[model samples]
Target: MNTINTHYRLSHQIQDEAFILSQAAKCNLYLSISQKSIRLAVMDTERNKFVVLEDYELITVFTPMQVAEQLRLIAQENPLLQEQKWNTIRLAISNIHFTLVPETLYDPAHQHDYLRLHSDLNPLQDVVLAYRHNSLEAINIFSLDASTYQALEALFPERQLQFVHQTSTLIRSVLHLAPRTNLRSMYVFVERNYVTLLVVGPSGLEFCNIFHYLSPEDFIYYIIFVMQEQKMNPEQETIMVWGDITHDSSLFNILQKYIRQIKLGKKPSDLEYSYKFHDMFEHRYFELYSLHLCE
Candidate 1:
């Protein structure tokens, strides 16, 4: 039994009428697809803000083929998706197969070797290899599951979909919204069974990685261990967290006990949104919203 969580047309309710395709403004589509969920959002180019947003979860396990079919069907019937020319389309993958390497030493020709070292996937698994130039020094190289990549490709063929590590978007969100942060701080993005930790220091991205967890205990342990290992002073260092979590939740409680400064992340200061997004968590879609700002 697959479980789907949906909140549709929050924007249309605020805008009075639907964002019809005939409107001359260009729009963008952002998708955050993972092993367990698919999130889609639309941002009106003229308005420089998102207008339509939706997400779905799979309670039951499915093969990659099943999900690709589901996403295809959703696009076929979506009205906001009808005729607008998309300026940019982005997909962020949460798979652990991704690894970051130094840009100066990276060979555009050797992506396969780097990807294989980090992921156990067969080199010939019909996967598409790609990397995002994350920063002046860091680049994320990873594998996109063949079926999922092709499904997204077939859905929107007019413009090529830009892919990046899910954590990469988290980095983009922080840099855009909170560049002037604590001298040494950490950003935590929590999902159902996964966690992404990003450490930013004065220089640049200090550390970034994704980890899977089974319980709240396991979750806080990893966060604390990383901070300790980094020699971050719990008294002075801050941790800004977002996504699928709550302040009263066990995860938050555990984190608060160990870290002196724990706060929730906010929407990127660079973008605006309709009042429709007011009811939504300010941090829920940071990655999707930041995708528009991704180069």
Candidate 2:
């Protein structure tokens, strides 16, 4: 429940009084969930743009109840969050499992495959099941803790809450942001214990998956394995990375040895941000910011 990072952008000229909390009514509210913290953003439909509002990073993992309470406490502390109505979209990333089914063979009734694939790693006793259709890629069938879903729902009982429970939010975020070119590219989003690998070929999304690891050894192993299994030449295909990692990290060092091209991902260029975002790292919030673009 401890916040390790907080950033707010409000113009001194207008201040908080002019920009009322209810302004969120016109903006698309996005929340990205994780074990360590929750990230939020607001997109103004009128302006067809978005701004990175705030992020809450916890000091330690909190239970589902504690997570819900922390959300309440944080909202109470912010004037903008006091609004009674906000069009909200919650994107759960942590403790989520997803599998892709080719559209040609996709069937809505087969959603149980999502829960079945990862049942060993994540039990689905009280988990909510959902799916999203990717026109260009494939159907993403996914699952998340039902209690966590309830926790989020409890936060905004009065507002319209549409859940963006993508099986791989990081990959979907990168999918919309990354370029669509002929060059085979792999977008890697590294979290503390998980890494999302999305490979985009000239045609479309060739491969997209998430792998869990405990050490740098395990991280690189999975990366290399994906490349090898997909027949992507680590020496030629480009790899762009974002999230809780740096170029100096051991993971990056290992990746550099096998992969020749490595680029750092930046915030999605489509969104407009305030001057406050100018000082933050461009690579930090790809997934959270992507929540605004999630369908």
Candidate 3:
């Protein structure tokens, strides 16, 4: 197997040592070896606004072309990125990571099935850590299990893949390894086997949660429990729900009551990124969380 080392430097020394300890225990946390730099940006389709994040620093405005140009420059500098020849790359623009697959891919009626490989911070682990820190800043890494991995290969002989990272610290590190305004807080949620990611900052937060076997009720219960444990008032926080579960008006209504504000988090213009290079996914989820959260 091939491995890539990416490092990030932050302006602010994470002051919550207890929180860091908690995260390390729950999620497998490790320091990166290579201090690589990258730039990321996202567009708020509804507000007609653009937000660019570099090395944890935030840039007020950026066009789609500008984002593309930045990626091109990174690819030029990094040999591995240049090898991918990817049309686009997906980035969190915040300090979190998630997996995004076409909605159609999950349809049971669909005959083809292919496994998508993702590398980023682990969500379950990150949530545990973030809760301990009393901060939403976190990252996520995703990959398929052995059984699912094999099943996907049988379903789709041809691979349908995209590489993206949605971690807050990693995104900031990529920008310049220094803190920035655009890169804000991030949260991770998972249900069934799929991962849902949420990122918030000056431009407002976006949410995307997906699950196959778990019901929306279960997902909400977890959210409520986590918030309660962390002493977070859900009633004061804005929440946006997405995916098949949100289709149910009844469920959506219930969520709206519990959350400060609720909306469906989807923006077409937000789809832009350099789809190459996988992230590290070797650490244990619980270990990472415990190390980052628990004192």
Candidate 4:
């Protein structure tokens, strides 16, 4: 063993005064796993409030297997993860390999086929999964690393755990926040290596896709390309952004240079957060907070 390498760091941790290990059975534990971080939020479902939040940033992990190892290491010491019972448990895996198909055309048996149309799937390493967005009336077909999936399943044996793609949570949160106006609104969620962009029209979600970029130039290029393709006006339409970005960061600066309307996204408003959470940026951890909306 490599001693876990000090490869991960706890970036943010807040627990409400009401959070008690014994009361976990009345809370919902939400976990969001991505390439760079693992975040968990404990929502007191009985009170409709969030009581605990933790974000761990992985420093040395580059592969899913490595991430899984870090997860195992963290679970050993994290009391929340050690707890076996919660009102519900939801795990959202974030990645670029996912496709959203309209519910009317979705077939459970062809989940792989739906995802294959967008990315190549490796049967040995990837496990195909689908999440139904009842409100959106769409099905998100995605793949999770087989090893990580099994690790999570083994962690909470006999308990029902719902697994969903991170995009599904993002979509649910965005659609709920989207205004019922005729103008198309663009939303972007930034990660270490990629960005997930979603366009919401008067009716519903009009466009959703992910783009990988290497530099600030590449990042702005994708945003502009999506605007032109969607016939959105860069000078007029506003774009709301969330995740891994700061107001003075190069990414945000570039976005401002090209798009006239740029605003940082807000935290999910459907649920309340503990007073301890007031210090953290509202825009950060949008997906982790959105997991509460997942059903």
Q: How does each model score on TM-score?
A: 0.88, 0.82, 0.31, 0.97
Candidate structures ordered by TM-score, highest first: 4, 1, 2, 3
> What are the Cα lDDT values of the candidates?
0.73, 0.67, 0.32, 0.90
Q: For candidate 1, lDDT tens digit of each residue in 123-221?
A: 555464565555546677777777777887777677666887787778777766556645877889999888989888777678888888999888987
Candidate 3 residue 57 Cα shift, in angstroms, is 40
TM-score computed on alpha carbons, candidate 4: 0.97
lDDT of 2: 0.67
Where is model 3 more than 4 Å wrong at Cα?
1-142, 145-216, 268-295
Tell me the tens digit of each residue's lDDT in model 4 across 204-294.
9889988999999999999999999999999998899999999889999999999998888889987888999889888999998999888
Tens-place lDDT digits, model 3, residues 20-80: 2222212221111011223323222233222222222113213322333334334445332
Q: How do these models rank on lDDT, best leading?
A: 4, 1, 2, 3
Model 4 is weakest, by summed lDDT over 10 consecutive residues, at 1-10
In model 4, the number of clashes is: 0
**Superposed Cα RMSD, model 1:** 3.8
Top model number, TM-score: 4
Clashing pairs in 1: 3-59
What is the per-residue lDDT of model 2 for residues 1-295, given as tens digits with 9 covering 90 to 100? 6663333222211122224455776766677676667666666666666654667766554565455556666676865556656655555556546667667777677667545765543454355355455656466666656666666566666665666553356656666765677777788888878888888877767777778899888998898899999888787877888888887889888888888888888888677766566776778877777666666
Q: Note the clash tally of each candidate.
A: 1, 0, 68, 0
